[model samples]
Target chain A: MKFNHACKLILKNLFLIFILTSGVHGNENVNDKVKKLTLELRCMTCQNQSIYDSDADFSIDIKKLVKQKFHEGKTESEIKKFLVERYGEYILFRPLINFKNLFLWLFPFTILAIVTVFLIFSARKK
Target chain B: MKRIIVISPLIILFIICLFTLFYIIGNKDPNKPPSALLNKNLPSFTSKSLFDNEIILTDNDLRNKKIIINFFASWCTPCKVEHPLFFELAEQYPDLYILGFNHKDAAKDAKNYLKDEGNPYTFVGVDKDGLIALDFGVFGLPETFLINEKGKIVYKYMGPLTDKIIKDEIQPRL
Candidate 1:
């Protein structure tokens, strides 16, 4: 009985050590991930300011939340999608190509098409 | 006749461009008119002064004081550039209470920043959470808000405050 109790105590201590060490290691990973992602997300309310730029209390809270989400094993895409869902694509200062934003997507091509047609017509006229 | 027609279009375009430039210049006054929030009371929120631990600043605390509230952060490069301008304002307006709301900074870093850079604020407060900034509708760093003695915000200026702002607009208004 005495030997068994001693073995159990040792196992508990080892388990505690593993938990503490892994918790710290996990926290560092989450912090790194959050910092990396934040550098990309623009603060929509602040023109030309990245999420990392303004020290607004909310931005810091978001940074902390991002770290927490990362620790939950969310992928970068998942994290970005979550922010978009909450704040809309406005949170991403860089506009993305989509059906709703089809004009934004189509604009360059539309301009090219117009230029090409004009060139062809002009050449034919000449 | 062809030259006259071509030259007229170019002159018209040049005039249009010149008119547009003047329009932009007129509208670009950093000290925005008080119309944004003429009679609105100040948004109530709480923050700790980055300079002193004992001083806790709240919206209610600003009542009956001509206050210049500046939002800034240690990491923001432009904030550093605008710091001198802020100092100039503080020096000029002794009665004007300059409050530095340090958003999203560790208290230690804020204290250190004050130590390194001359502390211009009458009180430096830490917006550790950023709730205060949101209440004031702060979307950017280095944004300054002018609040009247009654605690109503008279104007808000986005981006860095410049010498022209101090001399031409703010000083004249005061």
Candidate 2:
């Protein structure tokens, strides 16, 4: 009877440890997702820092909002679209690829291509 | 060939200089981000009145009238500086509807602030939770939006409402 009691206590301790460890891991996963999403969002109040980096009240509010939306099972794209609709494209650190911003997206590559072609033609001429 | 290359570079330099000059002179206050809601209809929201808890104000109340929506807080110093100007404007334009949104402020503080400063608002709404402010895309306090009779947002001023702003920008539009 004594041996049986000791085994039961040991098993209960192991079960509690396992549950605690698994709960911590689960929380870490959600925290990682929240951090990734917050990093992508600009702090509108600061205008210079990401929502994850800024300590502004507005940034805190935005972080809470992002986490709340995630809790509601919103996809990342859906969350981004919602913020974009409210705050406009200016809220995005990386400007959206669209008709108005097509040139902005393509301009650097276009310039690089032009420079490369010009250099190639010049080398051939030499 | 050498002359063409030299001349072309200089021409390009001059053109770049001209463009930079035009850009700098034409665009004043480059720090001010353009409001996304300009020309868009006001976002609908319902909030309790600051004065009377039973009274709720909505977007419907703002329609069919030339309205000025001012986002303010008791804690913001700029709002205090701009308070007298609002009172002056309120006195001047009795027909104009000015809605005061007490953003992210305590109800007691907001009421006390208004009492101290003299309430110039036609209808004051308390944005206690700031959800309404978020809907309006308000990043900071003391921003003002002018809505037309059609309920379209015509102009948004991001800073304090100075006398010059009232005389030049707002009065002309009104």
Candidate 3:
């Protein structure tokens, strides 16, 4: 009975914490939130630019979409995922390291390790 | 014959190294044009002044002061971050002329936006048509071109200007 009561109290505390934190941080101005998130997204076509970079008519339209998403109260990650769904993975500036991109993430370090090992082995043999 | 065979590989490797170096340098910044554009006369065009809708600012009028031309749009996010820095820069370089090319925006919207956000520009030009942007080879908004007093393009930054760049990169050139 005591164990069940303790677990209930812990759950209550966690719920209260969630409510307080979300109330404080979640009420950011919709425009500010959207502006902050847009810069983090990459431009689809323009090299090394964010969606917020280009003056293309399409970019302006995307900004309008972002403003709409803000009103929907979606999180930053949710907005990014929605963009990725629409435009594919190419929309992101920093590609997420996942199962599909595992090779890309590991290839650079693997090549560096191979080179170091080859150099050490060649030197020791000599 | 043996010496030639061994040296042949070495010479080929040397050529490959040189080619690789050139390729790396070439691909470093694809947006920046060749050095030929630098020190060339600023392109001439007439654009509606952002400050006054009826008035037009000619390229010839821009010859006297060292100007920093920023391409920005109301929809651009990085332009928001770059906006406050421009205000600080205007404060620092009172004599420095800062002009903005408002690419494809309504004059009333641009003016109202600037008024609300703090107008950092000395003069704003409406590029309702992106012809002016094309002349300068602009691929994106928030790009900055620093022109010398003689209207020669001295420096161009393809991204948002940070405090470090203002202090370390641009102030020295000024």
Candidate 4:
């Protein structure tokens, strides 16, 4: 009897957590989501302008695309992936953290680790 | 131990300097980065032909045949510079299909431009809203693509095509 109650409680808590997290994600206005995603995308026509900031034809089209994707119930990452596939990595301001770009992402941390090790070694010597 | 420690960062810096120098020395134009769609399949598209009111062109029409797709606008001045070259391309390779996409251009203006320039394209499609260019990841006006029999985009050029480019870059591929 006790085990059955415990199992029921765990299932109920899990369901609640899932609902809360999904609600938070879904409650954001579609326009706000579009703005946030477009901020990360580059305006291909204009030099050094994010899609959200640029009034270029390319930016406007991307904004329309993102809005459409959101309306189709696509997630942010899904939309980003679609954009990356369509336009290549140049369309993104932030490079993706994949095997090809793993070195780029970890290079700063590698430097930090080396500096820390060198500092510790010198301190010990002193 | 102290010498080795001091030399390590110097070694790393020297390696970095060498790589950076090699990259800078390579003939990479700062203005033009490489197109990302090289060797990729052309995006499937459908459009109404500029010449005919009822004719529609789709990706299926491009199957088992090599086609050169050129995106141009009547309003773009640079397109006029490359305008004459298509006639040459059409003349040289009679079997090769040349497609013209009149991007974001009015039907009347495109018809007038073609009439004035002497139409060389096998088919002219109307991309009235620039959506087709967006699909191709076109950065600016007057982009050209060479699609192979496999429907892969083998070569892409941004800006106007010159006689030299046609001889050196495009002819050898054909």
lDDT of each: 0.73, 0.85, 0.75, 0.86
Q: How well is each residue in A1-126 modelled by candidate 4, as lDDT tens digits? A: 999999999999999999998877665688899999999998877788899999987788889989989989999999998878767887889999899888768867876777787677778787
For model 3, the stretches where C-alpha displacement exceeds 4 angstroms are: A1-126, B1-5, B8-12, B15-19, B22-27, B30-36
Global fold similarity of model 3 (TM-score): 0.55
Residue A125, model 2: lDDT of 70
Q: Mind listing the fnat for each candidate?
A: 0.10, 0.32, 0.00, 0.32
Report chain A TM-scores, every model: 0.68, 0.79, 0.67, 0.73
Listed in order, the DockQ scores are 0.08, 0.36, 0.01, 0.28
Candidate 3 lDDT score relative to the true structure: 0.75
Model 1: lDDT of residue A47:
53
Best-performing candidate as measured by TM-score: 2
Give residue B118's error in model 2 in angstroms.
Answer: 0.2
Query: Which tens-of-lDDT digit does each residue in A1-126 have in candidate 2?
Result: 999999999999999999999999877876788899888888877857999999999888888888888878887888888888777776778888789888667756765765676667668777
C-alpha lDDT of residue A54 in model 3: 70
TM-score per candidate: 0.51, 0.85, 0.55, 0.84
Ranked candidates, highest TM-score first: 2, 4, 3, 1
Q: List the residue pairs that clash in candidate 4.
A: none
Clashes of each: 7, 0, 0, 0
lDDT tens digits, residue span B4-53, model 4: 97559747856875786787568875446577788999899999988786
- Estimate, for each residue in A1-126, the C-alpha lDDT of model 1 and write its tens digit: 999999999999999999999999988877778778898887655555778776765577667667777878899889887666434465676666678788657756765665576567658766
* Candidate 2 clashes between residue pairs 3 or more apart in a chain or in different chains: none
Instruction: Give the better candidate number (1 or 4) by lDDT.
Output: 4
